[model samples]
Target: LFHTLSFFYMLSSFTSSKISYHYHFINIRKNWTEAQRFCREMYTDLATVENAKEMNNLLKSIKDLSYDVYIGLYRSNDFKWHWTLSDSFYNGEIFKNSKHISNNESCAAMDNNWKWFNDNCDSQKQFVCFNGKICY
Candidate 1:
């Protein structure tokens, strides 16, 4: 209904570099850290959107355009966005989501419309998990 929807779940995946990543959606709601923990336990890490194409593909894959789901992006103490998976995939900021970010919000979630949002790390929301493999 709104951008602040409390609960929803879905998954998506793609390949990059020497890694073949498969993304999985978690239906349960959990804080960002907890989601990361769950992802690390069962998968490689939270979903990593390496570029604009991947983000767009994820949005296009989902049926609903109203859900706010967590991705692998989090704000570091250096005031930069980082992927939960390997940091090598992201060299620089492709989009300027940080200028709008604040001090309190550290984790990121992307709406179905593909807009990035910074939220409190403790806020509960649906998330995606990805497992990667070395491509041969």
Candidate 2:
């Protein structure tokens, strides 16, 4: 009912010895779970959009924005938002109390308008992947 997305980022503002990875946009469409599996096997994990700059950059990376994509965001059974890739694996304080259209919308995706929305986790769509050991 939902597709997965891939997102990669680098520490550009600061200096680091770790490898700087890039965000790769996979055109292949797959459900959120499938996309996450693929990303874990090949790259780091699904794309983790942190700030407005990253979101805008991610939207711009996709040449064709006619369709939405699955990001590395999801909701737990208890209704907590989380990113796929993280060291501490902290829960997202944001969207903790936000209302959604449906309780079935447990996955997060970005539409063609560069807007984030709740979606069914089974929806298949293109995704972005992140790469790098330094990224959170």
Candidate 3:
């Protein structure tokens, strides 16, 4: 009986700790900075694609893949890649090519192929936002 109770407790804890996120695709085209501002005002920060699952979710949320969309990825002044979402779980698996050849290419966007690429921040594009919830 004690073992069963412990197992149940563990299962409950595990289930409760799982983080769930709802992705929202905004079809309105805007620059990366504008998209980030809009996301912060409306929902959470711009979408953060951490893994294949998140990428798949993002792809599914968009009805049209004919155009690219801005994501939360950007390069700091030091040229290090970072996400607008502070707690993003990035493991470097989604970038098709990690090389950023141009210094002006600081912002990132998702292509039709679901791969990420660097782009100018001022270029207009649609974007995705996410609202994350911690289940209890």
Compare the candidates by lDDT and give the number of the best one. Answer: 3
Which prediction has more favorable TM-score, 2 or 3? 3
Residue 104, candidate 2: how far off, in angstroms? 3.9
| Whole-structure CA lDDT of model 3 | 0.69
Worst 10 residues of 1 by lDDT: 4-13
Question: On residues 17-117, what C-alpha lDDT tens digit does candidate 1 reach at each position?
Answer: 56656667777789898999999999888887654444444554455645678888777777766677775423343334466556668788877655567
**If scored against the real structure, what TM-score would every candidate get?**
0.72, 0.70, 0.74
Q: Of 1 and 2, which scores higher on TM-score?
A: 1
Model 1: colliding residue pairs:
none
Off by over 4 Å in 3: 1-18, 87-103
**Candidate 2 segments whose C-alpha is farther than 4 A from its true place:** 1-21, 87-103
Task: List all candidate RMSDs to the true structure.
Answer: 6.8, 6.8, 10.6
Tens digits of lDDT, candidate 2, 70-135: 888777666666677753232333354655546567778878755566788888999988775564
- What is candidate 3's CA lDDT for residue 30? 96
Better candidate by lDDT, 2 or 3? 3
Worst 10 residues of 2 by lDDT: 2-11
What's the candidate order when arranged by decreasing TM-score? 3, 1, 2
